[model samples]
Target chain A: MNHYIDVRTQIPRARQTINNNNIKTETEGGVPEWAIIELQGLIQMKKEDQSGPTVVGDLHYFSRNRHPVLILGHHVLNGKEVKLEQPMAVIEKDDTTSYKVKAIVKKKLLFKSRPKPIISNVSEKV
Target chain B: MDTCPERSSEDVRKIIKTAKLHESELTEVTQILRFPDPSKQNDNLKLMLLDDNLLKEIEGGNQLIFKGDPDENAVLCTSSKTYDIKEAETSNSLLLVPELLFAASTGLDETIVNKSVEGDSDSSFDKSNTSLNKSADSDDGKPPREIVHKDIISTFFTYYELKPCKPRLSKLIKLLDPTKYRGPELEYAVDKSKLYNYEALFDQIQASKAELDEELIKIQAIKIDDHYRLLEFDYEFRVLSHMLDLIEENSWPLDRISKDVTIDSLKDLVPESILEAMFGFYSSESAVDDGIQYYQYKQDKVCQFLARVLLKSAGKFNLTEFLQAWRDSVPEGMTTDESLLSGIALIDKTTTPQVVWGFAESDLPEDINQRFKVLFQTKAKWTVDEISPYIQLYATEKLNVNALLTKYARASTQDGVRVFSAKHMK
Candidate 1:
């Protein structure tokens, strides 16, 4: 059994700026506001994992206190490309749950830009 | 004018000091006080005027000198000529004590001085009524009257922080001026009662300016605009200067510049970028986010903003004391506490045990550990199967019900039934 879930958290990003010909670094921005991170994917529970309520063949979503596992929206990935409605990380709950499941997206739609017209009339016709 | 029997040289000097008489005016008044009247040939006049020669000589300068002077005579003397002593005494003007000068100069009645000096108990009410009548009678559309600088300062011990503020001084002039201090007709008329108090106010302003001059000598003044300027490189000065501009632009009177004035009210007057900079100047982003938005603003911005306003408006308010009071009175992290408490209360009141236990079982083990022990505990012991519904029903996240129960309660096996008791100690 597989289930879908959403996880939201904050991700730290390095922002750079130049001050008086010197590079300045900052951990946080000048003003603080809420940041929402979204993750969506199919989760399959491990058979041996017994910490929480997951049973074998059951899929679940997970969020953690402190880890930035993946930022998987439109950016390139190695090995196999699995397309998701939103970015998600493959959470290996335990060694038994780790399976060599390959996800190859036929078409990567998240990073897809606006498609150009097939034909264009150059004449200035209203 | 009745001859002042108790008048001494010290008394004469005090009048000079209080009125701030010039050198020549001093000479003239001295001669008048020291000389005896020659016009009165009576024995009483002879006894009073011990020095008849000096009296004759002073009588030569002006015919206004009286044989009998009032106990404390405050003569209004212009540079060229003195107003008739008889005329001054007979006029509706209040006796000019150094403190009363501002009141007289501003065209405000002496009643305020009387009210201030004598407690507002009873007599002042009558005096105020008379003052109102006087103001009504004297309501000619003229500019506020001028007074000497010495008259504006009060004799009491007080200090003004922003005394020499040019913008404030100009605004004050406008506020006191009968022609410019426009308001509702009733208010305008009522304020006119203080016309006699203008001289005292002017004296205060002048004293403030003098103090400001002394203070300015130690600091640098940077002109920021046509009407505004910075007096020091310090952050306090910067904030104060900006605050003064806001008060002036808004026409907030000294009494109206209170701490209750909201930061939102200043939104249009002060830019958000400056507020952000000021906030950043003292606090970090995370510190601000850890509290409620409004509480953050008050804790961070209230002092700098209020100090400036109070200094400009009331000419007082110690910054440290104000801040300490604010901290002591306001609870820390109240907003966060309120939010957490409300959330817990809502859930506890509306939700069932099964739902709460499921949430606890799934992702909030710690929360359940804290709340469930207090909420579900009773004298009777509950079996594992009896409590299983609460832990498993509506639970989406994977959780071990048996293992989690051991964390908060004591489990015992009796007659094939495993029972859990919250009060059972390990």
Candidate 2:
């Protein structure tokens, strides 16, 4: 009837992962921490019936720039690196009370602007 | 591009090689050729608001817990703070990208590539376009381009946002009702399971362990035989009244009351631990003389308890008479003020004799509307000062006492004093 979620147990595991000198990023031992890709509204799949796997869009960066561009069909979405007002920690609820932090994402990839069509695709090709 | 869909394929892009341009469509950006992960990760996943304090707690390896009964809403807790967990919905969809490099990481030396490059931009085109070899120019730039190989793991539309809240401890009072500590002799008659220890109560109550412990002490709950239990009011009054008599009989100054002496005298009435806990509850350390801790009896606390004992059975007392009896009832050198009676009792100034009634705030209904309804029913109108304490318990960080009143009650100025009444006068 009552429950208490324990986040303490995950701390030691997180520390253990950090202590392993060779492993720089989230490796196979743990659930890789997820960064948020915030898109305005929902990802409306064109084929609502396609079952196996859905490829929503193609995410890209022009040349070597840090700005991210997502191409959905012919529409291109231009989004910038927005620092999160408060850093977000992705917690995966395990069993009952055990919650583990996968990663703390300091920023998010926000695509709120209207998706512009690929007019730059042909024009920008070098 | 295929007419059926431009992209629908297995996401086996974990191997490190070089980038491959897909289709005749020309673009210069490095593509993150990815697919939805077949394994579902959204069902059990939930996002939490992390402030700096909470971030430090997670990093410091302190215990953070979420507590709730099956019927009650959940609350999150750190070692010393209690917070309400509210599932806030967002209009935007947040996609979960596991092991995806951030903007800061774009400059890093190591990068993962999807396919290999063998020649210049023109010679690298593979004519046969299956799912595997959908490639054109591989080496468009100097360094072999890196394409991210990862799953769009999940998406979130809502998150559990936390705001600091008072521990919902009214639930504890209910749970310990059946297991009141009458005395040591009747210990076996009481169900030990019902009298929950800290861990057990922690599971049942929507509160942090520290807050729970504080409330237990506030209500004079003492751990008897390993389980925390509230003392029966009548029995508590009896022991406290006896303890009060010792103050006059011994003529000990309030500040110099000895802990050892008090416990030694009351040891026969109840367990020494219970007396010690009560002493700690009613007194604060004033000084330590030769290692013996001297405490000042809390005037406000003692007066309030004494007044409750007087008012509990009397129900209603003439304002002047009640004040007189309360003053006489309290111990020497301790002053009793009307302000101390804020939540416990109310004076009906509108009445001819102005009778005072015992109306404990905790005993009132928890719901906001119901609480207002009862308050208005008891008295047709209440001044802002009179109504605030009763209603402030329902106030949250997002909504304060004023906001709560604006939503639920009708306010009007009477004799230049703003008074609150039920919204619907009928």
Candidate 3:
């Protein structure tokens, strides 16, 4: 059977590119180039993406400590374009729980000014 | 007119013999015959007459000897008229001679006159010479002067007055020489004793003796434990007991309390833990329960009594009016939902009397009159939470701990949400 897995937990690799006739990995520090590219793509997507209908999905993974973590339902992703409505959950495999986490979402509105009408009747009436 | 004949003849014979004698013999006879009482014609005069006759015979003066005896006892002489013979008795012969002389010559009376003239001549010569000498010396030109008896007496008195009666300063200095005073110490002491009153000097000595006695008494009065004993109990057990009541009434937090709380501050509201600590430490017993029991049962009654006393001493004012007025003036930041909720949370957690006291002393309006104005502000209504930080900042700067506590207590009560209309909130 084909089993589904969370891509967040998978180790990612940098893509090699030719620059000045030399091939080199694009990553800096220990972070993967694909993750940085994805974050930048997401930042750009939020600025340009219009409000529209889209499909949603869920993902699950384990932390380095083998903690049971759950991604909440209904996240929109279109390659570079992604939006989240709720926070992901992290549950340790231990017997006791010490604290809980809550989610927060904020939306800002921008309004445009309408053009004023020309006073063509003023001179004729006067 | 009735002349005696025998006196006259005898006088003639004496003059004839005086004329016959030499000057030297005459002088010798006159000296011998001179009588103190020549007026008596006695037998002594007959002897003088015989000496005069002998002197005349020796000097070779003629002596006509009368041979006719007028009487067998009397000597006789010739008279001018006749050779008269008279028998004169020797007893009465001396008296009859002067009578015979007076009858013989009228010049015999002139002889007494001549004797007075000779006597006055020498005295008059002395008087004139003395007067001439005095006149030549007289400067006043009035007359020859004699010393008046009164002037001589006055001059003697003047000389006595001018005579020195007392010694001079130099003489007194010589008598009291410093070199002599240093010679014998006893003499110096005697002289000094004379200069000062002995009774007063003795009194001074006695006063110094009394002072020494007083000093000894003061030394004896000093006790052994006086130095550090009082310092040991300077803060009494009762002081801690009083502090315990104050801690409970104000709800002071346990962790915040320290022994460093000034006696002046703790006097207002005594803490129970302080009393428990003091009693436990001093009495060597666990006094925690005793302190709690004392506070829970008896301390409240004591505090009420103290509060009544303090209230009586406090100034009179309409508390209702003051509270209402303060409520009205609460700042805008104090009456918001967020500030009010936060204030309530702070008040619930607060354990210290200082925090509660701070709220009680805020200056914000408490009346409903200004409530509408407070509700209109967007930031928040003025409440203790908003004003307290400022009061703490000010009170801390002023270093007034009492004011901080009072303001903290007042502010806690004043914290409340001010509900506003939707239009006003915007």
Residues B310-350, candidate 1, lDDT per residue (tens digit)? 23333223434433443443323212221211111112222
Query: Per-residue CA lDDT of candidate 3, range B62-177, in tens?
Result: 22122111122111111111111122222111101111111112222234336437773322323423543242232233221111110000000000001111111121112223
- Looking at candidate 3, what is the lDDT of residue B114? 61
Query: What CAPRI-style quality would you assign to candidate 3?
Result: incorrect
Candidate no. 2 TM-score: 0.76
Better of 1 and 3 by lDDT: 1
Error of 2 at B298 (Å): 1.6
The 10-residue segment with the lowest total lDDT in model 2 chain B: B9-18
TM-score of each: 0.14, 0.76, 0.13
- Over B105-133, each residue of candidate 2 has an lDDT whose tens digit, in order, gives 55321121122243333422242223244
**Candidate 1 stretches greater than 4 Å from native:** A1-126, B1-366, B393-398, B423-426
Candidate 3 off by > 4 Å:
A1-76, A79-126, B1-274, B277-359, B362-426
iRMSD value for model 1: 49.5
- The global Cα lDDT (0 to 1) of model 1 is 0.27
DockQ of 2: 0.22
Off by over 4 Å in 2: A1-33, A40-58, A63-65, A71-76, A113-126, B1-31, B36-43, B88-92, B107-144, B287-291, B349-354, B397-403
